[model samples]
Structures are given as structure tokens and as C-alpha cells.
Target: MKDYYEGESAVFPLFLVTSSDGAAWSRAMAWLFPTLLLQALLIVSFLHLIWDWFQKQSFNKQMFVLVWMRTVLGGLAAISPSVGSLEGMVFMISEVTLSIHMYVLFEIFLQSIVQAGIFLWLAKRFLILQRK
Candidate 1:
């Protein structure tokens, strides 16, 4: 009954908190903030494209297609399993949006090209008529 636990000893690992070397938590926050910001930007830009398209009342058919496609893609993204898997879906969304943006830009460009070509052709014809 005197001292059965007298010689018992216990050792626990000690965690040292140091300021000169930043903690793992701060480094993680630094990396995470930028990635989250980029994702946010992608979403914002896609939404802006949609708003602009609707505002213009142009490309009715293409706009409908884009609207439906984005709706489905966004739904899928919402239900996706986790961030890792959803990252690919986000890329897919970005690709689709960019493709639409490029198509819209190209339409404007090609229209200008066609208009210029027709104008020049008409000018050449006028010159021929004047020469005759």
C-alpha cells in the first residue's frame, strides 16, 4: 500500500510554437487565398459575358444555347463530389465560356471583313464603269 507507482514515468512529445518561422497554417492561408480569388474571377467573368449577351439582344440562337448549356454545367458543378473533382468541371465551364466569347468576337470581326470586301469590290466596279 505504500508506493506501487513511485517509479512510473510518462513522456509526451512537445510542440514548439515559434514566430521566426511562420506556422503551417499561415502558409496554407496564403496559398489558398489566391486560388480562391482566381476561381471567383472566372465565375464573375462568365456571368458578365452572359449579361452582356443578353443586353445586346444579339445572337439569339447562340444565346439560348449558351444559356441552357451554362445552366446544366452550373448545376453539375454544384452537385459535384468535392473540390478536387469540381476543379475539372470549373475548367470545362471556363472553356465553354471562352469559346462562346471568342465566337462572338469572331462574328464581329468577320462581319467587318465582309463589309470591307464588298465596299472595295463596289469601288472597283465604279471605277470600271467610269472608265468605260
Candidate 2:
């Protein structure tokens, strides 16, 4: 079986972003068709998930939490461009994915946290009413 990276690499622009220097960003952008396509799919999926959750559809909270956590960790891992000996290509791949993930994860987690807080507040009110 192909590695996940390999599966994505053939079509994704990760190679272009990571392997090129200053003169290559434009050319790399041209080669980034797969990456852009996947990003579109991601946006659709995220919209569906949010819509489904809001509609009271059954969904796992843990999945959102896990994605959120991974995003945060990945963002941190991409922070330092100067610290590692990794190839420029690999670093670029990490940095871009991390940045995208961080943004998506934060948005999802913000909604989740707000929902949880409201639920807790209601539960506390219910308990106080029962004690009267």
C-alpha cells in the first residue's frame, strides 16, 4: 500500500512547495492543482460537518476534538524554520499543512467549547432547581 504522503504527493502541491526555492513559487503554484482540489473537498466536508452537527445529527465529538488537538500540535511543530536539518521540501509541506489545520481546528473547537459551556450552565441550573 502506498503511504498516505505518497497518495497525496502525486496530486498534491506539497512537493512543489517543499522542493523549490524563491524562483519556484510561481511554477509551484501552477503544479499545485491537486492541493487546491483537496482543499476544496476539505472545505465542503467541514461545512457538512458543521451543518450536520447544528441540525442535531449524530456525530462523534471526539473526532472533532482529535482533529483540533492535532492541528494545534502541528502548528507548533511548524514554528521554527531554522531549527531543523530537514529538507526544504519536507519543511514546506509541514508548514503549510500545519497552518491550514490550525485555522480549521481552531474554528471547530471554538464552536464546540461554546456549546459545552452552555450545556454545563443549563445543567447547573437544572440541579439548583431540583434542590429547591
Candidate 3:
């Protein structure tokens, strides 16, 4: 069996599982499904928030809703994967796999935090303008 990281050099990072075996591919998909689902949900929620804003909803309300949704969904996505196994099935259980999962979780969490901060700042500015 060809190792997923076969023929890789120090100059390049292994970003994907290159193995051709069915088990490897299945394992990759199992790990990827939830992440993709959460991302799709986040995008849909964002679009809905934009629609609400265009509909003349209160800016503060919209900001709060967006931030809340992002926080909840982002946290769920971050903790959804087991890293070592899924439903008693082990897939690509290796250090590289673990590293990839950690990287993706961290990225999701960081993006959520940044977006929430930006939304809060915008809400504060809107309130100030409304007061004036």
C-alpha cells in the first residue's frame, strides 16, 4: 500500500491525502463531511443576515443574530470531529491527519472570532451614529 505522504519532500507541504485506496478515500470523506456542512451552514446564515439587513431590520439585532449564529456553529464545527476515529471507524489515523484536523479547527475558530469582533464594532458605530 502506498503511504499517503509518499514521495513528498521538505520543500512542499502535504495538504491532501494522495492515496488511491478506497479505504483512504472513505476515511478522508468521513472527516471532511461535517466540516463542509458547517461551512455551508455558516455561508447560508450570512446570506440570510445580509437579506435581513437589506430588509431594514435593526442593525443591532442583525449584528447580534449574526454573531450568535457564528459562535454556535463555529464551536460545533470545531468540536465535531474526533480526530482519531469516527463512529468506531478509524480513518487515516496518523499524525498528519491529526494535524490537519487541528489546523482546520483553529482556522474556523479564529475566523469566527474575527468576524464577531468586526460585527460588534460595526454595531457600536451604528449605535453612536443613531444617538447623534
Candidate 4:
């Protein structure tokens, strides 16, 4: 077992055995497996939400437009810092804390926006199809 580090702080523990041959593969799998699993779960949940919304026959065009705007603006705001840094541009902006906590919050926010958009869009499309 070894501790992975970024800068001076120990980040996470890496469990390793005597065998070096399979170490790289194991490490890759450790990261990839959980990511793939979570993505699959999210997709399944989002689809379920869409189905539920359709079954309930709840579709609002006004709300869809509002959510679309929110999602687009929120996504742009989240990526602005990275984009500005990469472009060597600076604008008057309040300092935002960058930490694990902030990262998790941003991820949750983005995921909600995505799920909401998907749900509303599918519901609207299905409602239209039913009408025609």
C-alpha cells in the first residue's frame, strides 16, 4: 500500500500487492470502473425521470425555456474561470474558492441542470407527438 500525493499533502491510498505486472491495469480499472458505473446509474435515473414525467403528462414550454437558459448560463459560468485562464484574459471577478467541496457542489449543480433539461425536453417532445 502506498499513499498518492499532490504537492505536499497525501491525496489517497493506493493498495498494491507484490505483483508489478498487473499494477497499472488494476489502477486504471480502479478509476474507470467506478466512473463508468456512476455514469450508467445517472443515465438510468434520468431516463426513469423522463418516463415518469411523460406518464404524468406534465410539459410546460415556458418552464422549458427558463430551464434551458439556466442550464446554459450556469454551464458558462462554471467553465468561465478555466476558459479565461487558458485565453490569458482577466476580468473583474470575485475570488471563488477551489476545493474538493466546491468541486462536488459544482458537479451536483451541473448534473441537476442536465437531468432537468433532459426531462423537460423529452416530456415536451412526447406531449407534442401525442397531440399530432
CA lDDT, every model vs. true structure = 0.43, 0.45, 0.53, 0.47
Off by over 4 Å in 1: 1-23, 53-80, 83-132
Q: How far does residue 103 in candidate 1 sit from its true spot (Å)?
A: 41
Off by over 4 Å in 2: 1-96
What tens digits encode model 2's per-residue C-alpha lDDT throughout 21-86? 455767767768988577546644654576545435223453344344334432333354311212
**Candidate 4 TM-score, C-alpha based:** 0.32
TM-score of each: 0.26, 0.28, 0.37, 0.32
- For candidate 1, the lDDT comes to 0.43
For each predicted model, how many residue pairs clash, with residues at least 3 apart or on different chains? 0, 1, 0, 0
For TM-score, candidate 1 versus 2, the one ahead is 2
Write candidate 3's Cα lDDT for 1-132 as tens digits.
Answer: 133345543111243454544687688788797986787667666766676463365655655555555544544333343322231123333444555444544555566667756756765698699999
TM-score winner, 1 or 4? 4
- Candidate 1 lands at a TM-score of 0.26
Clashing pairs in model 4? none
Local lDDT at 110 for model 1: 53
Q: What lDDT score is found at residue 120 in candidate 3?
A: 60
Best by TM-score: 3
For model 4, the superposed segments whose C-alpha errors exceed 4 Å read 1-98
Best by lDDT: 3
